[model samples]
Target: MSKLTKYLKITKGVRVLDLACGRGRHSIYLSTLGYKVTGADLSENSIAYAKKFENKNLTFMVHDMTQPTGKDFDTILNLFTSFGYFEKEEDNLNTLKSIKKDLKPGGRAVIDFMNVHFVSKGLVREEVKVVDKIEFHIKRWIKNGFLYKNIRFKIEDENYDFTETVKMITLEHFQKYATKSGLEIIDTFGNYNLDRFYEKCSERLIVIFK
Candidate 1:
């Protein structure tokens, strides 16, 4: 996050929007650095939890990723793989457009997304785990270039299933969406260390746009 703030040229008194922020971790941290911070998330519980940190320079609210915010900000952060949850590609693109719309002129958007190529390379077929008396049987695979996960859990004889699918959106895809949204790609980093990205070797694909 420090690296991200530096890249975005965030300084004291700047307004920052933590889009899809979960529990306001980054928002609260940014506010401590004297930046006005607002965290928006789809989860009501997360928003409620985040409100505990609210103060003069910090706030949180429920927000949908596809919708534009009423205010613009000097920096917008979508961190920790907080994107690509939608079922449709268009929905994902709209989220990018909303981020572009919510930024002030010359403002930067920092998006932290998974390095799909690397994940696909290390794809785990199946596994089992027991945590807190619950057993989880997990399976992962790639189909049509999209990663899918299905976790079957059993707790005290009760079973449940969870499904997740995220499209393998590459940097090229990002460039396409950014161009369509009237934004320009400025930089791309591989991980928190700020290394240059390698599609096959990088652990993450952190992108910056303006």
Candidate 2:
């Protein structure tokens, strides 16, 4: 989140909210810079681990991004493809709405997600991995305009199946959602270092909006 440094030049204090902040790396860095940072995640384990770093200006909590937190924030960071996990498109839109609700009148938001236009061009269909004593067979595909990953794994004599899905959302989709959620995108970057975004080449879709 070093890219965020450029936007932190405010004369007074800044309050930042990090959505899907697993383990709270971004929150920690921002807090060190004197920003009042709050890291929120649905994973109990992640939040518990992040709480260790809590201080007067830094905190972590379990939260569902789709709901409103009712606290105004100066900056909101939704990094690492954390925006589209909901099964319903409307639920995903709610996440954006909640971000808008938490933002101060002139607050900014940054959402970093995978560039679907580029990823689709080089997508892998299948793979296998063995971690520890467990073997995992993974399959990937796109259906209904969404990307899906299926994992079949064996732990000792037990077999388990899991699936992950992302909407393959593009910049166009975000633009539509942002407008309805009262946000106006101010900039778009392609990488962590704040490079230009490309439709068929860039690796990341990082947008800074208000």
**For each predicted model, how many residue pairs clash, with residues at least 3 apart or on different chains?**
0, 0
Candidate 2's C-alpha lDDT? 0.88
Clashes of 2: 0
Which consecutive 10 residues in model 1 have the weakest lDDT in total?
Answer: 1-10
Worst 10 contiguous positions by lDDT, candidate 2:
3-12
Q: How does each model score on lDDT? A: 0.90, 0.88
lDDT of 2 by residue, 1-210 (tens): 554667544433688899999999988988887788999999999999999999998999899999988899988989999878888889878998999999999988989999998888999899989888677899999999899999998776888999999998999999999999989989999888788898889999998888
Error of 2 at 123 (Å): 0.5
Supply candidate 2's per-residue lDDT for 40: 97
Off by over 4 Å in 2: 7-12
lDDT score, candidate 1, position 78: 92
lDDT of 1: 0.90
lDDT of 1 by residue, 12-37 (tens): 99899999989988899899999999
